[model samples]
Target: MNVYLGLGTNLGDKEQNLCRAVQKIEERIGKIVSLSAFYATAPWGFQSDNSFLNAAVCVETSLPPYEVLKETQQIERRMGRNYKSVGGQYKDRVIDIDLLLFGDIVMNEADLVLPHPLMTERRFVMEPLAEIAPDLVHPVLGQTMKELNA
Candidate 1:
């Protein structure tokens, strides 16, 4: 399966954090097919003095969506992230790995959501995603990444 992931960090060595996360993803998940340039962005939902350095990645993996989520979460935990933003409460962290898309699958389980619910609305995600997968379409929105980014 081809999956898209959004990586961001507003704490510690931002560049190294992203690099390590990408490396771990390749080692534990799958080969990285595409990676966007790192982008500097502000905190999205919560106020923070730290600004985030964000990027997007496309990986080809044999693992199912749920497994992908589990691995990504584990990656975050191993990298010093204490908790995920819950109930729309965001925070600065050492690393955040969001599973943006899992092929064309649309799912709404309590733990995972494919074609990430807020991906299109966030420039931090769409800009990098559009960079690497301009023509990739959102299964739920029926719009290409390029279009969404615009």
Candidate 2:
């Protein structure tokens, strides 16, 4: 399976945090096929003095979607993230690894959502995603990443 992931950090050594997360993902998830350049952006949802360093990654993995989510969450926790954003309230963190897309699958389980629910709406995600997978289409939206990014 080909999966897309969005990585971000603002609470620590931002570049190192992203690099470490990418390394761990390769170790735990699968081989990374494509990776975008790091982008620095302001916080999205909530007020934060710390800006974010974000990037997107495409990976080839044999793990199922749920397993991918589990591993990503574990990666976040191991990297010093204490909790996930609740009720759409975001915060600055050491690392955030979001499972953006799992192949062309569309799922809305309580714990996971494929073609990530808010991916298209966030420039931080779409910009990097488009950079690496410009022609990749969103199964639900039926548009290419580059188009969506526009």
In model 1, where is the ten-residue run with the lowest total lDDT?
109-118
- RMSD per model, one decimal: 0.6, 0.6
Give the runs in model 2 whose Cα sits over 4 Å from its true position. none
Question: Deviation in angstroms for 64 in model 1?
Answer: 0.3
Per-residue alpha-carbon lDDT of candidate 2 for residues 1-150, written as tens digits (9 for 90 to 100): 899999999987999999999999999999999999999999998999999999999999999998888899999999999799999988889999999998988888888878789998899999999999999989988999999999
Please count the clashing residue pairs in each candidate, in the order shown. Answer: 0, 0
Candidate 2 residue pairs in backbone clash:
none
Off by over 4 Å in 1: none
> TM-score for every candidate vs. truth?
0.98, 0.98
- Residue 95, candidate 1: Cα error in Å is 0.4
Residue 48 lDDT in candidate 1: 95
lDDT of each: 0.94, 0.94
